[model samples]
Target chain A: MKVSDGGTVLAADVFSSRCPSRSVLDHVTSKWAVLVLAALAVEPLRFSALRRRIDGVSEKMLAQTLRTLEADGFVDRVVTPTTPPQVTYSLTDLGRGLTGHLTGLLGFIQTRLPEIEAARST
Target chain B: MKVSDGGTVLAADVFSSRCPSRSVLDHVTSKWAVLVLAALAVEPLRFSALRRRIDGVSEKMLAQTLRTLEADGFVDRVVTPTTPPQVTYSLTDLGRGLTGHLTGLLGFIQTRLPEIEAARST
Candidate 1:
């Protein structure tokens, strides 16, 4: 993780279209991805529970978003031995670190939703 | 802003497709819109400066994003009555509040670019 060159973090910038952070930004900001991250931030849940918690998310979309999150190192999927083999998904330290702000935004959105709707009407 | 009966925030969940939060989430997470918000969170910038700040955004895209942000109440367009009537774009209070997380996520992505890259290459 030491992407340091003279103490700089390799000059990664999301604003730069060519930068890798740009693509990561795309993944992180995807609507489903954000919802999944926010849900996991509250607590780890099995795939089914997560799908249920995020209303309107199809099984296919949830699986896809989870795979992307897992690839980005923001989520971890674990399987347990059981009668039906339970699978749970949770944010890794990296995911948790990033999700702090996501949850903050979500709360802000929830609080200001009425204002937002008002603005839209006008 | 009080859409509350029992102190509930009207259940405006972004996770629900039918929720107004869904459309709001779409706007917030759009690649260009996110870039615009992140760019503005830094400082108020004119159209040209914003385009420059977010590399590779076409003029049409920038205008469209700005219009959406303005309509969504996340951005304000102020016209300065100078010789040519300069226009500057900045986040509104609502935009600023939500942008806290956007900036946080941007920083996270920038710092962890190397780690994310490593994870992706595998």
Candidate 2:
């Protein structure tokens, strides 16, 4: 994609358009992403704590989601220099802002669960 | 999955747990789902109108999203029986509610676009 302004030509950067932004979208809205955001919204938690908090999530998936979120700067992963190198995860400022949005989305889903279930029955 | 409620043994329905609700989640937070809900929030639009309003979406994907939203009762699809069938799509009360959620999510994404972009560039 290219945009021309006056006499100067500006390349919109197709790599930027189709690569990072799209990838970020996919990560933020992934299945685990929603739940993880919600989980971290309340407070930072340890790896195992997060794994247990979210019901029915596999450890592998959780780790993967956390890594992606970390890469995207939505999650802050801290490693404590402990006996076993205890790692904790928390939301960054931006991540917390994103969590507010996640809360709204999840709240809607939880509140409307009954109605949605009813609709599906028919 | 099995649950015990006092003296009553409840045989938890696995199919129900894994099917409709999950299916609904897949549709509601789907890439197009958020946008479709947001689009309908403004006003009812015809099929082609919606197709055009959303950028970079394929016809097949739009049609699929509309059908899923319709089936889930978030969207009301009206077909006028004329020489040429005129189909319009609008949000149901439930859909509007869902849109409120989507708005928050998308609003966050849009507002954080700059920060997110910067993060990805690194």
Candidate 3:
């Protein structure tokens, strides 16, 4: 329908091909995006720490995912003016809200693995 | 850590590269998978109806997504012994559980579109 932001109203429809929400949804649910959100859910982490926490994620993918999340207002990127220029990433309020749902999905999949595997075999 | 199915215990870890849950998670969260699940959440539909409901999904991608969801025990495929053989796809009990979380995520994204767009413009 219509989403009102201050005085500016926007049409919202994920089912539409031209809706921006489609892209936003894709970014938030991307493989690396889910893992990054999961890792950050534990604690805010620097770039290097984030890379280590998620298995099988390349440097480029991680960077791209973070940028997409940041642009969507789900991630906060802070730069420390240190000798080495440290940057840490954490979930914003919006990001945390989204992460709660993602965490639930992840937990469901993890706990029900046996049932899922059995389903596959049968 | 451990998930027990009857007497057989399974280790559950999505963070590990070798974990089967990783693949399951991928299937559930895949672009087409999410849309297909969402579409089926309404009611059981045949292959053609499902393809029409989701925008921008190709014939090949729709078939592949349905097969993946079925193999994961999230979808049930029923075929009728008619002249042309009618096939219908619907969510299993397990699929319903996961669909709840996915519907929540999709709703959140749809409702927060304005905020996400504002974040991008800033």
Candidate 4:
């Protein structure tokens, strides 16, 4: 979607917020949103697959995160035309951009895991 | 602090946790951590300065966030040996790295504020 000169995308539908950034922060950093983004960062995955990848996320939280991300234009929910319903999720172009940023933060956190542990020991 | 060849930084002191990455994640992604990171991203500031910069943050919450960031080694708490006692905060190299990543996420959210707001309207 093309952003207008004023920075409003497609006339500002339901996804728009007065403080859009705060809303995005709420979603991106929400309880399950970060994990969901990280899980989907690898590849398009089905619901159950996502459940497996994130260490301790519950089904309900997973579903909620997906829904929130979907609404924010950071994720695409694709339903395949098959006998048993098949719904898969992947990052949108916008979503991919977000994933890159979040992953950078996650990567730093991962590498510093030991130091973080050391800091909390006392 | 230099990381050893074994990947343990400075012999893994008090900050160490069983899952250091998870611990860092908890501190970085906590309700107020992100805001604190963002506020400090621009420049080093005193305690009250940060409180004023991040709108809607309470004194108690700000203090708590600072403590958590300091514990994780992401913030440097420099106290001035003055009669009245003065403390200042800034990101460490590690903290700066994390801030860069978090800001990227925050920037994306800020620009997409309109989209997020629009999404929530329904």
lDDT of the candidates, in the order given: 0.86, 0.74, 0.89, 0.75
lDDT of 4 by residue, B4-113 (tens): 64565553221233444655676798877887888888889999988877777789988999998988888999999998989999998878888988887777766666
Q: Which tens-of-lDDT digit does each residue in A6-47 have in candidate 2? A: 887554321133433445666887877877888899889998
* Ten contiguous residues minimizing lDDT sum, candidate 4 chain B: B11-20
Docking class of 2: acceptable
The interface RMSD values of the models, given in order, are: 2.0, 6.2, 1.4, 6.7
lDDT, model 3, position B50: 91
Ranking of candidates on TM-score, top first: 3, 1, 4, 2
Real contacts recovered, all predictions:
0.80, 0.26, 0.71, 0.41
The candidate that wins on lDDT is: 3
Regions of candidate 4 where Cα sits further than 4 Å from its true position: A1-18, B1-18, B115-122
Each model's total of backbone clashes: 0, 0, 0, 30
Better of 3 and 4 by TM-score: 3
Instruction: Give the candidate number with the greatest DockQ.
Output: 3
**Predictions in order: chain A TM-score:** 0.89, 0.83, 0.90, 0.82
For candidate 3, lDDT tens digit of each residue in A90-120? Answer: 9999999889899999999998887899999
Q: How are the candidates ranked when ordered by lDDT, highest leading?
A: 3, 1, 4, 2
TM-score (C-alpha, index-matched) for candidate 3: 0.92
Instruction: Quote each prediction's TM-score.
Output: 0.87, 0.80, 0.92, 0.81
lDDT (Cα, tens digit) per residue for candidate 1, span A1-122: 33455666557877777777898889988869989999999899999899888998889988999999999899999999998999999999888988987888777887788889988999
| Over 4 Å off, model 2 | A1-23, B1-23
